[model samples]
Target: MEMTFPDAAPPFLADAGWAGAAIEPIPGDASARRYFRLRRENGTAMLMHAPPPGEDPEPFLRAARWLDANGLRAPQILAEDTGAGLVLLQDFGEVRMREYLDAWPQDEREVYAHAVDALIQLHQLPPGPFTQYSLAEYQREARLFIDWFCPVQGLYVDLKSWTEAWEEVLGPLLARQRPGVTVLRDYHAENIMLDGGLDRQGLLDFQDALVGHPAYDLVSLLQDARRDVDPVTERAMLEHYITQSGAGPHFAEDYARLGAQRNAKIIGIFVRLWQRDGKPRYLDYIPRVWALLERDLAHPALAPVARWFDAHVPAALRDPTGRLGGTFAV
Candidate 1:
């Protein structure tokens, strides 16, 4: 994609003593935020352009500061102009965990071990400065599946029943998150940077951090949407986390609940990305996410949700593929 800096980006970089730095635009994720790598004679830094109205940099700044303060590896902010939505951050370099793992599949166990350890490390710390991931939030997110996914499949699923089913299962589990730990909502391999080393994993896209159940991030890691995580590696890491974190026996159940919730949300999001935003490429990941959701629904904790799915959506309509069939009536 042809990329250009936002209007305020140049002056903002110049004020930060990066005048005339070569700018190379970085491909963005599913968010409105854009990024560029700034290269000067001496060093390199990352410029995050979270444009106003659609995107804001304040939450990212707050999360970055909190993570760094608590000894995590969120990028250090060299300069910022929140009003203009521009931030220059420490460059963590190109070694993302997902890409690295693809190249060295043999290192999966060890690399995943390091990631599990990082989660244990974070869960032990006090929650970051973010709102609790409340039951309402969970329900609202779960509704996305019916709202977006069902319409695209040309199936008018029961939105009310979907909400009730999620709430029924999610309510009791919600109590366990009291005095919760920081949850990086998107803590998958793609958002993890392995620049320095495995021990010091660099966190990216953590602006959506929440104070919630520890299992949420684990689901994000082990059941990634973008790529397939080996089943053996996933099981080993989950066991490793339970052992190292000293979590209760019920932790596995909670992991399944959150997995169902997250995967369902992702399916809705991928559809929205295609139908609303005209980004159809995200549709390719729905099959993978559907498989994860199917496993999640099998767990007893998600029985209510499973029944809802069984009653409303047919197996043939479950996995949406290739430029969905019908118009999503908003």
Candidate 2:
């Protein structure tokens, strides 16, 4: 029995004389949440079916309200039935950044600049109690690489050694960051939409936004797995962010470090997505993400983590980890 909005449609919909509308399923992310496009006499709206008793729509609705209040383009919650996990949200269209970039690669930088600007605006907002990022949380996420990827690839990793080195090197580096800003945990291509009608973009799946490093979202955008953003464009975007934020020359180093950290986390995440979630589509992008990580590691700021990866992980593993649609060559 699949749970759906009709099962939980608000009583007010009937009281207000709203007829049941057609629902079309939309592609979803890794979450169990599902979306449907609904059409009524009035217009179109998005219906979220999160299922009953298992998931709650309150957090998402709260975050959406907070984001909308802050000049961000998160969908406004029209109505919600928290007990049944159903919500009606404003439709933001379906032009995912991935699709937009594929259709016009040349225009990617400009469009992505808009995304970065949105991120900067989000980061500039004052932090709230609901948002915070801790090193312990990051370390736990990083471990997904070892837990999920190692078994899927039929390889044994000395995670104990890796964790010790990771803490010794990357830990302190991340610890130095000034936190307390809205960090959209998955601020990547798929979660952004290029809505032609709005003359602007919209943000999606931002329920995980937290107070963390401002550079984290930047890395998430540029070092995306589903799309390949050129280094030249990435550099220009970085410079644009620096200029806009009025950050000093040291900002470059911070950006590089954050990039390295974000890429490492993604490498682990992609592998886990395939091994645990049956989403092997993400594997093909590993090489590009690894290449970006390698480049960032070359920066002086990331030397410690670079040396740790070089010494612990075999060089031959690079191509094998990245080559999708085939088994590891080495």
Q: Top TM-score: which candidate number? A: 1
lDDT of each prediction vs. the true structure? 0.89, 0.73
lDDT leader: 1
Every model's Cα RMSD, please?
Answer: 2.4, 3.1
Model 2: residues with Cα > 4 Å off, grouped in runs? 1-6, 9-18, 52-54, 169-176, 196-199, 320-325, 328-330
Residue 273 accuracy (lDDT) in model 1 = 93
Error of 2 at 323 (Å): 3.8
TM-score of 1: 0.95
The Cα error of candidate 1 at residue 58, in Å, is 0.4
**Candidate 1 local Cα displacement, residue 2, angstroms:** 6.6
TM-score of each: 0.95, 0.87
